[model samples]
Structures are given as C-alpha cells and as structure tokens.
Target: MESSVFFENSEKKKKAIGIIHRVYLSQLKNSRKYLASTKTKSEIRGGGRKPWKQKGTGRARAGSIRSPLFVGGGVIFGPKPRLVYKKINKKERKLATISALFLKEKQLVLVNENEFLNFDQIETKLICQLLSKFELEEQKKILFILPKPNKKFWLSSRNLKNVEVTTVTCLNLKQLLKASHIILSKESFDLIKLTYGQQ
Candidate 1:
C-alpha cells in the first residue's frame, strides 16, 4: 500500500483528531479500575448499638458510632466501586487506531521478520542491540508489533522497562498512543495495511 493513503488531508485530519481523542478517552475509561470504595454508615462494623441515648446529658444526640460526624465513622456520599466503561463502536475504534498510526508515522519503523528470528536465545542484549541498530535506544517508550506471538522475542524484551512487545491481533489505541516509537515487523505492517487500509 502507498504511504500516501495514511496521510489525511486537512478536513480529514480534523475529523481524525476528534476520533483519536474520543477513542483514547474511551480506552482509558474502560481499563480504569473503580476500586476507591468507602463504607457507608449501615455497613460499618460495631454500629449496631446506639453510642448514647438520643437525649444525652451534655453531649450532642448520637445514634451509632458509625455516624458520619465521628472521626472513624462511615463516609457520606463517598465513592463506591462502580462501572465507568465507555463503549466504542468497532468502526470508530478502527478509525482512531488508524488515525493514531498516521499521526505517529514518523516514529514507525519497519523491520524484516528474519531480523527478529535471527535471535538464537532469550537475551535482553539482543533486543538492546536491535534498538541501538534502529537508533531507538533513547526512546522512552517503544512498542513492538509482531504478526504472531514469539515467546523468545517477548521474553528477551520483557526486562526492558521502556520496551513492550505485542502481537498485531492485540493492538489497541492505548498502546499506539502511549508508544514513543513503534517497531513493526514487515508481515505485521502488511497485516495492518490489509485490515485497516480499506477504511
């Protein structure tokens, strides 16, 4: 496929920008864990009995020790675990992924499959050498897209905090947008072209 196909014109670029933003936000929302939960008065322990009589001597009227007014009491209107997923349509996601790729085209690097297959053992040094060869050693976040899963390659690159390896099938907008540089195998590049080029 021609590289020109990935280059969007002015009007299309505007639309792509919106799509990319929406998709990126949606990805973040869906992956977020709503674990910030607080206990309510009823759910608090040791709250079964009233702390004091409703008509107390000099203290304020107290019901349960779990009242929100207490220091160790349950929270009021506090956060609870709930879903915050934003559903993104398949076509919209595809367009956003394509748009991200287009925007980051300068950071994309293509390599032959043989280059990775040449690694005989699981060694971080090999991956480091490869990055040095591509002049991506200084990049903060590098993503490797492979046509298929390779245990050896994945293992070799796993130790690098800045490098991540993933198969094309698992590619998503979050990964693409987070990467400072994306290394694609020739076959993986072709696969992406075939899958997203038509759109």
Candidate 2:
C-alpha cells in the first residue's frame, strides 16, 4: 500500500487543529449519559397524618414523618432522571472530526492491512510484540481505529493498558482527542475520507 494512502486529505493541511477545541466540550457533554434519579416528596412513606394539632403545641408545628426535616425524608429539589444530551449539527461533527485528523503529527501511525494478515493468530502478547517493533509499546495513550470492528482484534488489544480499539463508524471527536498516539488501519484511513471528505 502507498504511504500516502493514510494521509491523503485535500483539507487536512488547510484545517487547523486548534479549531476543534471550540466544539469539543459541547460534543462530549452531549455524548455522555447518566442514569440519575431522585424521590419526590410524595414518594416518601409515612406522610399520611399530621404529627400534632396546628395551634398551641409550642413545638414549632410538627408535620408528618416524611417532612424534609425528618431523618428518612425525601430529598428537596434533588437530582431527577432527565436527559442532558445536547444536540450537535452534522456539519459541526464533521468539522470536529476533520480537525482531529489534522491535529495528528508524528504521533499518528498507519498500519497496512497486510501486516495484520501476517500474524499467525491474534493475541494480546502478539499485538504487543508487533507494537514494540514500532517502538510504540511505551506510549501512554494509544488509539487503534479499525476499518471495521474485528472481534479478534478488539479482544487482542482490550487487555493492554493505554490501548483502545474502535471501528471507523464508531469514531468520535472524544476518542480522537483522548489518545496521544493514533494507529489507523488501512481500511479505516479510506473510510474516514469517504465518510467525511465529500462535503
């Protein structure tokens, strides 16, 4: 395969990496989700009856067992289960992704598909040894973008620290920015262009 196959991009050179930070946080915020929930006042038990008469008890007017002041009472205005995802435009997503591609310097490495085929079998140790050949074993953060999701490849790299494997379709701005070093499978390189370069 040609070395230029991985780096060919009409806009890569003109694109500024710094531009991505503008929308990075927004994209990240929208992507994350949490299963948060809280109980309402009425949901609390034992609030059925009044604790005392309304008038002259002189005890500051006690209510039911489920009052906010009570030990086991429901929380007041606590977090509720609601979606917090922010909407991002397709153009913005494309811009952010392209910016990440442009940001890569010497840290980006491309692996030809033939190299993977040379492996007798896929294994964690085998993948590590392969990376050592590139002197990449010590890299603190590495991301591998496969052209397509390969279960064997994912399993092979899953156990390695500072290593993550994802397919082209799953690529996002967050993963692209998180890694210090990026490895693009030959197919992934082409797919990125096809998916994001036309516009």
Candidate 3:
C-alpha cells in the first residue's frame, strides 16, 4: 500500500492525485520578516555635525546625527540587525501544508496533476476549462503554488492581476487564505509530501 497513491472520491483505484493532511493554520508560524538582518553600518553616512553651540541655543543640546530625533537620522526602534525569520517546527509546517493540501483534496485547491515543467498557453486554456467546469472563473483570488522559478509559468498568470503566484518554499499563510482558489502543479505537490514523508 503505497501512500503516494490515493483513491478517488468516486472511483476506486482511480487514484487521487493529491495528498491530504489534518492540520490547522495555527500550526504554521510566519518564518519570514520584511525587516530583517539590517547592517549596523549599511553606508548611509550623514551623521557628522554637532549642530549649534552646546551652551548658547535655548533648544536642548543635540547629539550625534544618528540620533533618532533628527530628520534623516538613524531609525529608532526601527528595523535593524535582527533575524526576522520565525521557525515553525518541521512537524507544524508539515501539518499546515497538510491542511492546505486537504483543502485541495476537496477541490477548493485545484490540482493540475497533468501540468508540469514546461509552459503552454494551452495549459492555461485547460486550466480555465477546469475552472469553468467547477465554476471557479469568478474567484476573486486564485493563487498558484509553483514548484520553482519558471519563466513560462510566471508569464502565464502575470496578465491576470487577481491571480497571485508563489513557490511552495515561499508559501505564506496570509496569501494562502486570501485566495479563494489554489492551483497546484504536480511536482510541487509531491515535493511538499516528500518533505514530511507523509506520503
């Protein structure tokens, strides 16, 4: 009994194309931060003058140009030399992925097991056809979970503003839930399954 293969909902031995897992969104933690790893001295040099006499001006004495109070001064409590990436335990990440995949299993996430490494306009056509069959064309947000960087694939959906694309490795919880639909390529789906040996 190989776990990689699955039974279709309607046809026995027909083989379900996608994997399924029972998990929750909470299991997944945001592991990336937009403001991270700032260089202590990233070459933004402008902190030079003492600014007015120390004993003459009524204004409070000023210090380094890098002071956060001054305009163009170094940022205070701002993004700095810190790692923003949060780690979700391997099990939790897998669990979240599984939860996502389970949604796919129910057809909320469209699995194009037939789609692959190459790009094809006809592929888009076929995908549209599937959407049409499922009445998914009107979906406001459709996200594509790509396996990796593929120029052809990137171009396929660029024209559609509502269609968002991302790689499995770059999966974000907000983006995942924001979309009403998810398109999964066969290779990327397998990679996720392999990640947990859940298959």
TM-score for each of the candidates: 0.86, 0.79, 0.48
Clashes of each: 0, 0, 1
> Over the stretch 1-199, how does candidate 3's per-residue lDDT look in tens digits?
2323543343432222121112223323244445563322224486566777788779888756656676666654556544444445665555555554554454445456555354655345544554566567745788778787666666666666777778878776566656777777667777767664552
Q: What lDDT tens digits, residue by residue, belong to model 1 across residues 9-122?
A: 677778888999998888888999998999998898887788877783788988888899998899999999998878899889888887788788888998988887786789
lDDT score for candidate 1 against the true structure: 0.84
What is each predicted model's overall lDDT from 0 to 1?
0.84, 0.73, 0.57
lDDT per residue as tens, model 2, 85-148: 7666777678678657755646788888765555555689877876897788545788888776
Position 162, candidate 3: lDDT: 76
User: If ranked by TM-score, best first, what sequence of candidates would result?
Assistant: 1, 2, 3
**Better-scoring candidate (lDDT), 2 or 3:** 2
Better of 1 and 2 by TM-score: 1
